[model samples]
Target: MGSLGQHGSKGEIELRWYQGSFYWSRYKLILMNVRFESKSDIRPETLLVELMNFTMKETNYKRLCSTKTVSAVNDNFLGPTILVHKWDTFFANIHDRGKYGITIHWHGIRQLRNPWSDGLEKIMKCPVPSNTSFTQEIIFFIEEGTLWWHAHSDWSCTTIHGAIIILPALRTTYSFPKHYAEETIVPAKCYKGDVMTIIDEALTTGGDPKISDACTINGQPENLYDCSNIWNYISSTS
Candidate 1:
């Protein structure tokens, strides 16, 4: 139910496969909150996402080439996109494997009567310490449409964030006309260095963090990063 293979009969299976292609982590239904509705005995989908250190390859811009060491979820800068239905409950088992602490926050998700997963970090919940894991229960009862999930601890959100797509509940139909396909485009600023270090240096010096170098669409800087391209590398497959 993400950017591709989101319709027809095999869409669901394809999406799950896409999740599998990202990181081979163990996941299963662990707990069930009775308040969450049971449609066809729906159970929680446990997602085990790991936070670790890695290096991203050359994102050459103009005459510059770079290989930046950074921290990410499942070795990806843009973390995993969570696909779920309205009124469905899922668990995010976040394991922090980095040097510092971290926590995840689901943006635009309505956690009514369940504030534990709100992910306020120091305000509501503490950060998941390094080498430890924390399980967050997410139940969306009323909210829908394209949302996001990001790191709630310190400056981690700059590198750890992903999409959250909430579809219509079971036996429910969209009030408006439905499209045959969908696309998820994230318009963001492209930075060439370690964002966590950028912020940490800024905090220590009381200076503003590094300004974004390029504006990107779907994580690509288009011709802004490379000089020998016309339309970047975005392709459409039918």
Candidate 2:
């Protein structure tokens, strides 16, 4: 449900110079134009796959959540090395008058046997209140092979889930065999009616919102969204 919405007032993006180089010794003026795109409400499952397949053409991958941006700086010091530790807070929602909270569970990363980093309620603490926040440091252990994240408390499967994969620093290149390229997927969905209306109409009517239809998928929408025109576009494209 979280996406970089249509750009207008809030505009949905910000740009700043992250790095600069001075080449007075070269005696010639040269400019390298590099642009990086960061996102908000990014799902970790998609992010990890992107990271695994990256060709090192870009220097970093950044994400913004709840007015804060987190960047996983890509270091080519020896090879492809990414340091995944260090963060002040993670952004997720809560409900039921602060009775429940959600934690972004990092499934693949090892917690070094630490409960707080384990992303488990029984192993750690309960979820916090909605709109509230917390600070924790989670270390990424690449040796675990496969990693995933999910919420530790209520409504976990509904809102909090993602996957994380760490690679060895020595590896230099990424390659995919013939059929492997088509094996990956990322899921996205659209609401039948305006998402805002679910809460808006409920407040206006003083009753719980009733949603009659919803659509879910395992990838981005390949065409524009319209009721009558939906299948026609797919048919034409095929």
Clashes of each: 0, 6
lDDT to native, each model:
0.60, 0.33
Candidate 1, residue 149: the lDDT equals 83
Residue range 117-137, candidate 2, lDDT tens digits: 455665576655454655443
Show where candidate 2 strays beyond 4 Å. 1-99, 144-146, 170-215, 218-238
Worst ten-residue run, lDDT, model 2?
A: 26-35
Error of 2 at 217 (Å): 3.7
Candidate 1 lDDT by residue in tens digits, 122-143: 8768988877777877876676
Off by over 4 Å in 1: 1-64, 227-233, 236-238
| TM-score result, candidate 2 | 0.36
